[model samples]
Target: MLERQSTVGSAPIGSFVALGDSFTEGLGDEAPDGALLGWADRLADLLARRSPVPFRYANLAVRGRLIDEILEEQVPQVAELTPDLVSFCAGGNDILRLGSSVDRIAERFEEAVVELSSHAKTVLVFTGFDPRGTPVLRRLRGKIATYTAHIHAIADRHGCLVVDLWSMKALQHPRAWSDDRLHLSSEGHRQVALRAAGVLGLRPTRSAPATHALQGRVRQPQRLDDLRWAKEHFLPWLGQHLLGRASDEVLEPKRPQLLPL
Candidate 1:
């Protein structure tokens, strides 16, 4: 498929806007000030180092957002913000639900990419994480794959860069996940940032730590860990599901405005 003419080389990616749920918001990876410093932020750092111009970044992602919420709240802002680049990854939350339709979610996703493609100089989209790493989430792998296919088709149609998370083998390790088993660990995020940079046709500088995934394969896990994860993490998440509550329903965005890095 023909890639849209990217501003990656012709011009600097001075501005980036991130939209999605907790993953894009940098959950599981906390900073000293108690804010998320996820892959998007790390990608911004990588971009800033490469570009001659100053970079601005905004993350409008909250923890429990579905694709519809992202469409209503985030997609409309793309034109107004007019970012040089926009990273969008949503619908994972919807995929996790009991009776969710992947087709319906894909339609919403396509709508978002269409809007994003219209306004941003460069638009990047992500596939769902490979669930094999976390035993608890592994049951939904088939659904995730179906949704991931839709994501790829949407990216192809819109000429957006695609980050195929499901194909990242390093993520299949236990260490790559957080205690919650849902979000990526700090090490995992680092690896993902490197992958994102590679997709944008950029290389990591010597100063930046190399992705662990690049070196080799990681070790396997113990069966006992699964039981412990179920007790400590999965049960609470199940409770939240039963109660119809969101992780960050009332919490304002950590980074609402596009500020210089």
Candidate 2:
């Protein structure tokens, strides 16, 4: 967790803008303020409680958003906000749409970051959890990992923060998923919120129950013996230790092209 000390009266006061897709929109069996209870609202609530001044939140998340769409419309909106803090959650749709090279995703993300950094002091970017273990939507883990790495490298180059959400408890076990399997359940969302709170230096508030009953019935438990070992071991370790911190190695020479893989 990042250490944040309140400097008497120095907490910057400004609006917070969240730009992303369904995760940001909180699409599931939950609702807050007549809308899906997404992470951005959760983050904003946490920040308001922790900071010295109250800040407003602006959510610009639309469901089914791809990287190209984000770059086209959302990026410019975020750039215009000039917010004190900005949270970006993208790339899942990219993996879904174009399972191409990592370099390609990196280029798109880098452009988004360049525009974001020019306006905000701190930007929080999310790398999604491993999706290979899912029963229905399995087999895309490699592509997702490639896209995640691209985003990570871009965040590294720009000195932004990342939340390695891909490494949490859900990927290994069958119980972590909601009925839909793609989106997180209310509890799943809460767990994610807790981890995100740890990253953002804020506290999480319990989400309200959905106005409508949650769809998708949970499936019977199946053993995860067929899943890859790296899904169980390496990804979680990276998320806990490396994702949000600066590189530890001392360098005689500094070059972005030679960055660690």
Candidate 3:
């Protein structure tokens, strides 16, 4: 875990904005209303509880966004909000690309962080988690580690607080992940929200139900199950890359404006 900076003390936050791709957008953390209620939302709820005054929040994230796309589309909007705090988690999609350059992605990501940091009182960044149990994603663990290192370096240089997802052992469990094996399940998002609250020096007012109780025994995936996932998710992802397309090509930001929560 990165040390909490003195810049953002254990005080109540006024406003917050979240920026990134699917993870930040809360892809696998679906609600009964068919809406995404990701970690960002849960974190915002925690912030709201900690604050005595009105708390405003916004989430400017979309699925399948690359580092550059986040820089180009979300940064300006988030900068305009000038929230008390901002959490950024991007570049995972970029790292998954075949010929993506880790160095370039880091450079662009740092630029976005720098820009957002100037506007917000504090900026929070995240390191990607190791997808060890997932079949195909496990193979890209090396690349994920490399990108996570770059993220740490960038956060250090900019004096940003980091939520070190890479070091979280709880996420290594298969139950923490969704069927897609890429995004976190609702329980996983809740755990992340609790950790984020801890980083911000706040105790969660409410606790999320334990994942073990909600998710029963998780058996090792069968060979056929792996093949089915490859056909359904991996192959389509590859096709999108080959065609220079993204899943969120026609999608809009989940929360475009800062509003009271």
Find the candidate with the highest lDDT and give its number: 3
**For candidate 2, what is the total of clashing residue pairs?**
2
Query: Per-model C-alpha lDDT, please?
Result: 0.82, 0.62, 0.83
Which candidate number has the best TM-score? 1
Candidate 2 has which clashing residue pairs, if any?
A: 26-38, 129-166
Model 2: per-residue Cα lDDT over 55-155, one tens digit each: 66777776666677778868787656677777788767656543355567668888888899998777878886777656434577777777777777888
Candidate 3, residue 96: CA error in Å?
Answer: 0.5
lDDT of 3 by residue, 1-261 (tens): 222321257555889999999899998999999999999999887777667668899999988788888888999987579899899999888888888888888889899988998998889999988877678878889888998999999989999989999987668777787887778988789888878877777653454457345345556788999999999887887778535765555888888899998
Cα lDDT, model 2, residue 163: 83
Query: TM-scores of all models?
Result: 0.90, 0.71, 0.89
Instruction: Give the clash count for each candidate.
Output: 0, 2, 0
What is the Å distance of residue 85 in model 3 from its true position? 0.6
TM-score-best of 1 and 3:
1
Full ranking by TM-score:
1, 3, 2
lDDT of 1 by residue, 1-261 (tens): 112222375787889999998898888788888868989888877777666677788888877787898999888878898999999999998888888999999999998998898899999999988786567678898999999999999998889999899998767776667889888888778778878887887754453454454446655457897788888888888777535765555766678888888
